[model samples]
Target: AEKGTDRSTLMDILWDVQRRKRYISEDDIGKIGQAFNMSKTELEGVITFYHFFSTTNRGKYTIYLNDSIVANQSGRKAIQRAFEEALGIKLGHVTPDNMFGLYRTPCIGLSDQEPSCLINFKPFTNLTRDRVFEIVTELKSGKRPSELCDIPKSIIHYTPAEERTVFFKPYRQFSSLSILNTYSPEEIIDLVKKSKLTGRGGAFFPTGLKWEFCRNNPSEIKYIICNADEGEPGTFKDRVLMEEHPELMIEGMIFAAYAVGASEGAIYLRAEYMYLRDRLEELLSKYRSQGYLGKGIKAKTPFDFDVYIHMGAGAYVCGEETALIHSMEGKRGEPGTREFFPVEKGFNDRPTIVNNVETLCAVPRILEMGISKYLSLGTKATPGTKLFSVSGDCSKPGMYEIEWGMKLRDFLDLIGAEDPCFILFNGFAGECLSEADFDREISGENLLAEHMQFRFKDPLEYARKMGGIGLRSGGSFMVFNKQRDLLKILKNVADFFVAESCGICVPCRTGNFLLNKKIDKLILGHAEQQDLDEIKEWSNIIKITSRCGLGKMSSTALNHAMLKFPEVFEKRISANTDFNKSFSLEGATADYDRIINEMTLDYD
Candidate 1:
């Protein structure tokens, strides 16, 4: 009962119920719904929207194995089989003893260390078949997964000395806060503007501009939401920032609160990072004790601000600011059509400023280091260093602090990319580039230009007219060597979008499903040139009509792949155009047969 029954606290209360019971039973849900004044249907919708929350029993120790493309490339199938063998249960089933449940989940922000799983929400990385057996054995012997798994360290590489690094530098406690006392809200915004910092969370919106807009809003109660929902597959840089340098992010949020006159703030952490919740709460408590947070922080200013940690169950669409606010309000995590921006109407109809983990973490460092020094780090158009989660076909697959304007070729060399042929600049929702585009510079200038050009015309035509691909990344740099099957990778990416789509709009829901089917056709050598044309046509429809970024960019990697490597698809296309010849009757009836057999067995 410590957790209030208010609608706002529904997520927190549900998390408690899930933890205590291992699943939210119907009786528990009824009680929660009555207390929160919600309907059973509404509560069930909320529960089913998130990947982590479930209504059925998930056994005492649940294992969510990562099934991302990178995980498969790193022998995830073998490790999965080992876990099944050790546990004596099939995937997606609980053991007869109910001591273990195995399930497959999307990427948990651990691409660098593939073949990973969250056993009771604690990450166990770089799993081999032998390691899987040992882990199951340990669990059977009453060993806690937490006791066996150490906190995963940030595998940052190809960076300069710690002193030179922006985030990893030695931090003086409350240094930025002390500086905040000297400046007005206007001055703080101006400093950020002069520094030329953009949102590092893929949108690339001007940081200072966003703050100014929020500060200008007339709402008395404003909010500062640090978007810690780093659900983008192949991206874990935010995870490192939150784990190692959460203080910086907290201080940054305090700075934002001071600027925008926000009394309360929250860190909407993703469910995958549930392990870090306790440590973060402890840090917040410590800050309160030391006067770095709470009313009249440090007793030198009029600011009255405090921040809380809000846990996300698991919805990739919640990474969008609108969907995030809806989730925070104890509603289904669905994106709303933006009649007004978040800065105008957000988080219970109050003015809100939503910044990503990297954007906020940089705020304190920018103030502490001064504008000139921060601006000197990267190109003039896009100043400051960005943390990239580098993985796939690299000798060093981890985090790297790269400045803007670095050539794609240079970055590949720095990361020791092994015969890199294709690269996914961001996550699946971002662009794809081939070796021919290596000379392009990774900067905001090209990205902004590309955005403007792609808004009205075809991206492939624009690329052809410009003579090459433009480079822009949201800090995910996944390199694929020649040995990697591009079609298989595309199929995995298609599957991720299908599973993660929130299904609020018809375009996103149906488009992703149809796109996945088309990708399967291509992979199976049943796709003809007409199928390729239909893929492009469907991709355009999804991009143009989709309500949110998820549907809009769901086909981005597929579109880019077809453009960059036409030969890959061309080779797979069958000469026969007859749809009847390609159709498989047995394959279509496989699910029907399985369901009938299961029903017969239950009756017997």
Candidate 2:
């Protein structure tokens, strides 16, 4: 093992071991334990947490069909069935020939282009029954992933490219990193602060203060982390940035490393993005060859910066910074108390700075252009543009970057949303608002003429007028049309929470399951008013008492749905008769519901 190798690199060793031998044998585990000076029990515990790494032979190829809300909406079930029929094997098991293993995976951040699946982490999106059959045929003939079919085109902007970007537009086209050298670490921090940048991973922590804290915390060894583990159901903006704008995102990471005086950085990428790993590593090698990554790359500079790309094995809670650190360390992806934040003691008890992919991508641009230029794009408190992953019932479903504080209605119209009924502002764990909301059509188009601008003196006040704080989403905007069933959508969101609970704390681990059960009851026409009251009570307990943010906001979609669309739930409640008539519950909901809402599967 290298000197930098420790328990944190346990996942990497396991990944390599599995790749080389199709499984981590007992002898290999013992040898890895000895190499890292870790106990075999500790190694086994780490290995068991993630679904990807296995101690036993999985198969020659692992086929992961994404069983997410969007996947089901886009007909993943039919596609999955096609795959099984073609392969002559059931899911979650290998074929009789021991050639393939099929399994269900959570959201793979391809909501806009679903139904999607991963063959050994190489994504094939926009799936259909015919495509599945074609893929299986090719695989049977010994075709590689790249030879199967062309990867989907980059899901970049929905609107015209002319209006989308300030830096990324030109930079990705022509600009290389200039490696700004005119400022000290404090000076760079001041510039970022002046830009008023915030973390885009939903927390909205001020970027400058985060960098300053990491910089102030002196340590012999320090780290910077670019969080690209975007497991949120409706969120795929990070995927866009990683695929279309790798250089820009990498430059951002490099700038953060320079600002925080750290040499090492890592992109904790989601396992679904395994296809991106090769291209990004090639780009990084180009950076190193161009004298950008290695020691003293800049003339007369003492900075030494380089980064590693680490893949996560399908854990949504790992999106949290602390939990991300633990996952990178080859441990279970569970968040800890904020008392010892990653900035103070993280990733093997060293000062670490973790920033979202968008935030890290913005750092270099802020340093390149003057902070004033960057600040001019967005609002007073919220500065700079935001990228939203817009899917569902929209004509232009893809990634769209807008100046912050765009009116909800204008955004809707701009994205060509048809009959915009309701919109999910963030992911499954985020908020959902509908045209039936308090200020339904505040997009200013309806307030005045269809072609008029929706000007506001203050964007925050405008958001308050239109709806709640959904305008400040971390960048997921799934537009649901009138044809979409609100009850089914709410249940989908509830079931996602149930499936993704990290199981570390009971309030979340148990509360989310019970919440899904209550939703199921309503869907099944078996619920009285008591179920609603109990659900509300359980939601409060989970939100207040859960150990992490995943649980704290797990009930947002359900709570909002019940409050805004009470009639949807009321219609499904049992009639005055003993007969139940709500089995549309089974057919109306997405296919993922059947998997998640199965009463036979018990969780501790």
Off by over 4 Å in 1: 158-164, 298-301, 447-449, 452-472, 575-604
| Clash tally for model 2 | 1
* lDDT of each residue in 510-587, candidate 1, tens digit only: 988998998898877778788899999999998778777788888999999999999999988844355566568999
lDDT of 1: 0.84
Top lDDT model:
1
Worst 10 residues of 2 by lDDT: 444-453
Per-residue alpha-carbon lDDT of candidate 2 for residues 1-604, written as tens digits (9 for 90 to 100):
6534666777777778877776788999888888887799988877777778888777787888877666777898898899889888888888877688888977777787888888877778888888888888888889987677457564566332443354347564214355455566677788888887777787666678778878888786889999998888778888888877788788887777777888898999887787889999999898888768878857224588888899787778888888899998878888866657687898888989888888888777666666777767666655667778888888888888776656677788788888977777777766677775524332212311222213546432432332211223467778877788776777878777777787889999999888888877777778878888998899999877877778888897888788877888777764425754455765776677766766447542
lDDT of each: 0.84, 0.75
Please identify model 2 stretches exceeding 4 Å from their true place. Answer: 1-5, 25-31, 34-40, 158-164, 172-179, 299-301, 437-472, 574-576, 579-604
Provide the lDDT at 293 for model 1.
77
- Model 1 poorest ten-residue lDDT run: 463-472
